[model samples]
Target: MIKKFTLFLLLVLPISAFAQRFSQYFSSTMVESFENPAQGIFKPDTTKMMAFNFFVPNLSASAYTTGNATTTLKQYLFLHNSTFPNIYVGRNNFNTLSTNNNIYVGMFKMFADLAGKQEIGFSWQIRAEGTAHFTDETVQLFDGGTNFNNLQPYTNLFNDRYYAQGYHQFSFTYRETLSPKFSVGYKISALSGIAYDNTTINQSDIIFNKNQSDGTSALYLNLIGQHRTSYTPGSFAANNVVPNFKNPGLSVSFGVEQHNEDGVHIQYNIKDLGFIHWGSDPHIYNFNHTDTIGLSSGNAGQNVYNGASFITQQGGENKSFTTVTNGLAEISATKYFWLDGEKQFKYNPILVASKQLFYNGIAGAFINNVQYGKVTVGVMGTYDDLKQFNLGGKIMFKSANAEVFLGTEQLLTSYDMFRAHRGNLNYINSNANFTGAGIFFGFALKFGADVESPANASSIPMGEDEGFLKRTFKNIFGKKPKDYINSPGATSP
Candidate 1:
């Protein structure tokens, strides 16, 4: 179980993708704009008519492990140590592991109308989200059955759960203004699932009885579990990661912005609410203990493993399934301040709370940024529902025509992880409650005719001809733009 779990966890880390780029969330970069749908990418007087990444991927990825498995996982995963990780059995204790990344393979956005407030965008990206939980007893059973000889029985110790999904996202995003202060945006996406793996053991119990006459141990295991995956064990293929319609899905994101007159910015979003259907014949297993072996052989542990295999075989099924995407809802506000009375020296503090739908994940972050002209540095403190606390920082260079940034959300813990990977054995004893790392970087450019505000435009006189979105869906949303959306609304788009 330990070996198998390790393999699965490793696979999920590299291939899986999902990200909440906090620093970039308000940066107004092409990636951030598409993510929010209601966020604008073009400013009439400053930015170009179009924005794109030219296939240069703007990406962020992160993974973390918690509970008693932290130390041993670091040693084995980073240092290639052969030592089995320590585990605390008998209690309903478990360890957790998660990995996420969001990669924009390519994106192109344009001003659909003369009014800078109306814009349309298209993008191709990859996204994923996942988490897993495993009990110490499960790890112990696979770690040479360290204490199985004892005359004790255990129940529910082997219960565990894992679920992860990854897919390609092709999106069409639209944003428009209501009355200059309030704007709305939405993104509709077609999704192609790349991978899906889910399994849960809701109940399990084990008892070992030894026959002193021949030292033959009788074993009994009662388990109930359901497992589902895109492919069978040893059948995972490279083509699975490539984009395809075999597993199709859809999602949509809606956003609203309130532009405050006092140099304050606020935005609300309902992002990625949708589902996917796995059309291919996925592998499924339903274990219920009826297939358990009669008795243990000379090697008691060997029989346990064999019994598990038998149940897996008896319960295996090939079928299709449906699953929901990891949707999100968030609201954020930022107050901007200019220091030194130069406007070039600026300070802004932001508060954001993000919650996940159909998943047990949420976070609240407080960010402080200081900027000097085109360069800005930010500090962030965040806490998540998983009880993890993090500190991170980022640096960005943004201008009217181009933007670039780099940062991490798990700075302190990532340092320990870095040390472990650097062959610093001392990291094994670090006092960090968890182990994780995150990194993100982005680059984008804008081109074409400079978007001109009404006062500076040479085009026809501006009138009450509303934007395309507002005209097309007038009844759907009848509101004025009292607020604007985009990262650094206090700065240029």
Candidate 2:
């Protein structure tokens, strides 16, 4: 009777389900300068610049029974086969089904401008993330006999669980203007405070004793695990407890910006160039457990054991789990050109084009890392001489972003390619035909500063000294500066 009920649940339960993927959001204010670096390239009159941002993402997953009848039945039978008595084995046919959510908040500000040439900045960010999984299974059998003698076969099982994890980060950065045209900056980030929480409940039906009248039976089991690690709030020390590989990493970036007299701009930066260790040792969890037994008319139920154990077996057996230490790098270039000159009309339109390339590993993950390219085009225009608006689209040529990945899968079977190990798990190797496309929309507002700086400092007297200062600095710095004052025969003093 217990087996029959388990089968029924597997067949009748809703088969439509999906899996979630990682999603990231940057604070609108934190990203304000990302869109147009020119807007924030110079120190504002105010020494302090503060911004706040929030990000939220929703992910989900689901799987349904597949394969030949025998294969499916064999997989079904394995669930009832138990290697250890009292071991819990809830619904098993459904491969993957669950939803995960992640939220991130970041705050940043420029605290001080040293000697009006060097600026110091600081930022603090945190993330709250969690995942929940659900599954159900049931079996049914029928025996022939008179109404009073008839036997009702029963089988039912259900399990649900949730896992939660979080972390926090604090970073400091210093920017120094080596010359009027060239500058260098460095950032040191320290992260700490990691926590985890997990819970699970398993239910099944079984008969304790037979001989008397049939009686309904049920079993309930619950398991929970929680851990918290302490670390220095603003520094990484030997005693610090790292969170996950993805969460515990330090990064440094060196960037150069150059602007031509024609308003063309270019920038390059290498980020996540370092490694971080989350835990002193790897943690492994084994998920292979089963229960199997059959009831017959003339003998005790037959026992079937699969020798599969659930949860990682401790002692003598070691698993290697490490996070990526080498980080990726990015290079970007942009050009701005006038679309409409309104010296006569009072309003002007400008168009900007940018291209970016990202390689998973900078030092070298060449064969193992993934790389992609992207292009963006935008138009900026002033309306009524008081307001401005900008619109643009970015085309990517590589693996699809998380959003595109989940959306495309939603239109197909409930099974998630990554969860089922159906194909290459890496984004680069995933079924390319199915994953590759994302579109983003954005705009900006301007309130002050309208006088455009003369492209060539030749029009102003001090322009020559400024231009010479920038050129001489660039030569010494090995990188050109953006917006050099226009001047002929200008030489550094």
Candidate 3:
């Protein structure tokens, strides 16, 4: 039982993926309160408003293969349907295999204002995240069948790593305008961990030798490693899904924004900046088991044979350790262009770049958004270092007291799923690897302040120093001039 469980835990779970939706930039939905706190004050209304957002969930996953393999999700899934060779190993080099899955459910989120100038929000979320990485040598030993005996003597192989955690989050946010052009916002989160596990390898190797006399030969093995697991018993059961507070953590997200007279805005944000320290009572396993086993008949002048596997497992004393939260760093610029002389209709072009600091993933996107009256639409093109290329869009309707939106990062897959084709399942028949795909659908109900008019809303009041400097510059120049740097309007199309 222990051996089976160890193998499952070490080899099954994989890495993580980013769950953020790029369409949020154009939706103008209340969920932006969580995505970018500074947005809390951007609407034109001054009256206090309240809103609840639901079903805004995002999922991300990816598979790792040989350097020359098909890395895209669609291509990999197609390949999986047909003929595929055994694991590919680089010549005298280590081949890597990795996988990650991460999901976020908004559960329930709402935002309200302490006053017209200040916004406050709260949310409850559930998350499942994990990652697994291994090397070719490890794969050959376990999956190669008879190939295990062919390992070169004294060859060094290092290839075993994994981490997984599950938890629930409660968050609170506050945002306020420092000046009309400047605003700052931040969120504080408390996490209740449900489960956790990780493993680190120290040393592993195999040695082969043959006896000179009529006897059975033996192979020598040495393995060393440590692992940790923690969970409140029964916490994962369907009927007892609540995690205990015995293992809790805290984190913070903070950001600032500045926009000028034209529709141009610049913003910077750092999110999920914290860590979780597993409780002192977590379980620990240290492996140091090794043995020599004989193979072949002893009647031969010399026989070579051995079969010994299974790492020793033992309970460990209570010790606490920390795991960093999935943090992110982001910077973006957005410019709006008016489509009509009335300024009631406009389009915005946005460019954003972001990084998952903890997972070492980078992503960027370009989005074009058009809003006229109560309807807004957006299209986006996105890519990430993880080999994901996505084209998606969003459509939304807003009223004085409500908003609804539907969007997908995998629009093509969603369309295929709805058509006569087998949807993404088509790739499953091939020898392809399905990396990741998801859809986002959610709605918001609002109460208070009338819906602000996007075209007629007044801009933030200028800071005293800013106004004085601008006036002075205009006087010296004989006429007010364009602010190429801090101006609000577009620098280009």
The ten-residue window of minimal lDDT in model 1 covers: 479-488
lDDT of each: 0.76, 0.30, 0.57
| Residue 309 of model 1, lDDT score | 57
Model 3 misplacement above 4 A? 1-14, 41-48, 54-86, 90-116, 136-158, 206-222, 232-240, 291-315, 340-345, 386-388, 410-426, 429-434, 448-493
Give residue 27's error in model 1 in angstroms: 1.3
> Residue 40 in candidate 2 has what lDDT?
33
Residues 1-493, candidate 2, lDDT per residue (tens digit)?
3233224223222121111110101111223222111123233442223332222221222222321121222223334321221112332432222222212234233423323244344555443233333332211111111111222332333344444343454556555554444444555656543533333434333332234344422212112222222221224343333333333556454554454456544444543344344453334433333333333342111111111112112121223332222232433344433334632211112222211122111111000111122222222211111111111122212111111211221222223333323332332222222211112222212223322233522243232323333456668865444333335555532
By summed lDDT, the worst window of 10 consecutive residues in model 2 runs over: 360-369
Give the winner by lDDT: 1 or 2. 1
lDDT by residue (149-207, candidate 1, tens digit) is 66676777888887788899999998887655577889999999988877788888777
TM-score preference between candidates 1 and 3, better one? 1
**TM-score per candidate, chains pooled:** 0.88, 0.37, 0.69
Question: What's the CA error at residue 78 for candidate 2, in Å?
Answer: 28
Residues 258-359 of candidate 3 have per-residue lDDT tens digits of 776776787788987777778835767777766654444431111111122234233345567778777789887898788999987979898888998877
Residue 12, model 2: Cα distance from true site in angstroms: 28
Better of 2 and 3 by lDDT: 3
Best by lDDT: 1
